[model samples]
Every structure is written in C-alpha cells, then in structure tokens.
Target: MIKIISMKEEHIPQIYEIEKSCFTIPWSKDAFEKELKENPLAYYIVAESKGNILGYAGMWKIADEGHITNIAVHPDFQHQGVGTLLMQGIIEEAQRNHFIGLTLEVRESNIKAQNLYKKFGFVNEGIRKGYYQDTGENAVIMWKYFKE
Candidate 1:
C-alpha cells in the first residue's frame, strides 16, 4: 500500500530523482534540503510504498494562502493515482494549517495536469507569460478557495 507521509531529510535523494525525471528544470537536492531543513513555511509530502518513493508534493504557506511549489510522480508510477494522492495530501495539509485558499501554476500546454487541478476545485484565475524559464512556456494560474 502506498502511504502519504511528511517529507524528511532522508527522502531527498529519491524525491530529487523523481523531480529530475518529471521536469525539464528540476530543483537540485540542495534546494530540497533547504526547504526541508531551513524553510519554516514550507511543507512537503511523499508517497511511499515498500521504502520506495513514488511521488512527492510541496507547498509554501504564505500568509493565509498555500502556494503549491511542486508535485510530481515518478514515471513508473504515473497514471496510478499517485498524483491524486499527493494532491489530497497537500490539500489536507493546507486545511489543517487553516489556509484560506490554495494556488498553483500549471504549464499552459499541460492539459492533463490542468484537468487534475480542476478536479480538485482549482480554477484558472489568470496567466503568467513565460512563467517557465526552461521552455519560456506560459503558465495558467489556478486557485481553490475554501469556504470560510
């Protein structure tokens, strides 16, 4: 059974591998370490089964909002509900922290990811031109507001 749990220092190497496999401009291991060890407002979780990490998600709690920084599932775990589980984990974490809303930016061309966000009640609010530095791709800003 895959379990969603809080990210730890030991999980960095595996999570970094997933990041590299999933994104063109992946974050370095040091960045993950800083987020886990130094960033007070950052929260991250991973999907693990049998000691192997299948996916991970992270966010930053800014004021009353939760800004999703990254969410990725390993290639072998893709389409197996890992992403959905990670999303649920992150949203639950946000709600537990009393966040008023959650926001994330999806690559404009990634309709699959956009649809996944939409399923979780995130709606397109605006666009950010050249949001992705790697490919100069536009981003579709999305937000999910919780009932007060």
Candidate 2:
C-alpha cells in the first residue's frame, strides 16, 4: 500500500532522483535540504510503499495561499495514481492550514499535468512567458480557490 507522509531529511535523495528524472532543470539535493531545514514556509510530502519512495510534492505557504513548487512521480510509478495521491495530500495540507487558494505554474505544453490540475479544481488563471529556463517554454498559471 502506498502511504503519503511528511517529507523528511532521509527522503531527499530519492526525491532528488525523481526530480532529475522528471525535469530538465531539476533542483539540487542541497536545495531540498534548505527547503526542509531553513524554509519555514515550505511543506513537503512523499509517497512511499514499503521502504521505497514513489513520488513527492512540495508547496510554500505564503499569506493565505499555498504555492505548489514541485510534484513529481518516479517514471516507473507514473500512471499508477501516484500523482493524484500527491495532489490530494498537498491540497489537504493547504485546506487544513486554512489557505484561501492554491496555485501552481505548469509547462504550457504539458497537457497531461494541466489536465490533472484541472481535475483537482485548479483553473487556468494566466500565463507566464518563458517561465521554464531549460526550454524557454511558457507556463500556464493555475489556481484553485477555496473561498470567495
């Protein structure tokens, strides 16, 4: 059974691997460490089964909003509901903290990810030109509002 739990220091390596595999401009292990240890606003969670981590998600609580920073599932675990589980976990955390909304920036060309965000009640709000450094791809800004 896959379990969603708070991310810990020990999980950074595995999460880094997933980040590397999933993104062209992946964050470094040190960055993850800093976020876990120094960033008071950051919240992260991992999906694990038995002893292995399958995916991870992270967000930053800013004011009354939760900004999703990253969400990635291991290639082998893709399409097995890991992403959905991660999204649920993150959204739950936001709601628990009384966040008024959740926001994320996704690559405009990543239709699959955009669709997933839409399924979770996130709607396209705007666009960011050249938001991705690796490919100079535009980003689709999405938001999920919990209240008026």
Candidate 3:
C-alpha cells in the first residue's frame, strides 16, 4: 500500500534522489531545507510504502492561488498510481487551505503529464518561453479553478 504524507526532514535525502532522477535540473538539498524552514505557505509531501520514498510534491500557496513547484515519482515506481496519489494529495491540501486556483508548468514534450493534469480539469493558460534552461524547452502553463 502506498501512503502519502507531509514530507519530513528525514525524507530529504530520498526525495533528493527522486528529484534528481526525475529532472535534468534537480533542486539542491539546501534549497529543499530552506523551503522547509522559510516558506510557511509552501508544502512538501512524500509517498512511501513500507519504508521507501517513491515520490513527492511541493507547492506554494499565495493568497488564493496555489503554484506547484515540483512533483516527481521515482522511475521504479511510475505508473503504479504514485503520481496520481501525490497529485490528489496536493489538490486536497490546496482545497483545505481555501485556495481559489491551482497552477503548474509542464514540459511541452511531456504529454503524459499534460494528460494527467487535463484529467483533473486543468486548462492551458499560456506558454513560458525557455522556462527550463537545461533543455531550453518551453513550458505549457496550466491552471485549475476551484470554489472559494
């Protein structure tokens, strides 16, 4: 059984590994630590089974909008509902905090992610030119509106 919960300090190392494996430009450990410490409006959640970290997500809520900062599942755990569960967890958190909307940027080439977001009612808002420097790829910004 996969369980998702708020990320803790001890899960940083494993979360770091998953982040690195998932992205071409992974966030630093210090960055995650700083986010945990200084960002009260931010949230990080992790998925685990038995004793392993399979995936995680981070988001920041500013006023009525929630911006997803990061989300990834280990390569070994992909397609087993980890990503879906992680996304659901984030959505619930945003609703709990009374956010009016949620948004994120997905790599233009990542159709799977785009489809997943679409399934949850996110629509394309615009494009961010060269949002990801490592690959010089454009990002497709997506948004979801919720009841206040």
RMSD of 2: 0.9
Candidate 3 versus truth, CA RMSD in Å, comes to 1.0
Clashing residue pairs in candidate 2 (N, C-alpha, C atoms within 3 angstroms) = none
Quick one: how many clashes does candidate 3 have? 0
Checking candidate 1 for backbone clashes, the offending pairs are none
Off by over 4 Å in 3: none
Residue 103 lDDT in model 2?
Answer: 98
Query: Which regions of candidate 2 are displaced past 4 Å?
Result: none
- State each model's CA lDDT, in order: 0.94, 0.94, 0.91
Model 3, residue 114: what's the lDDT?
A: 89
Please, what are the lDDT tens digits per residue for candidate 1 over residues 33-76? 99999999999999999999999999999999999999999999
Where does the lowest 10-residue lDDT sum fall in candidate 2? Answer: 139-148
Residue 76's C-alpha lDDT in candidate 2?
Answer: 97
Worst 10 residues of 1 by lDDT: 90-99
Candidate 1: lDDT of 4? 98
> Residue 93 of candidate 1: its Cα lDDT?
87
Using alpha carbons, what is the TM-score of model 3? 0.96
Poorest stretch of ten by lDDT in candidate 3:
16-25
Q: Residues 59-125, candidate 3, lDDT per residue (tens digit)?
A: 9988888999998989998988898999999999999988889999999999988888898889999
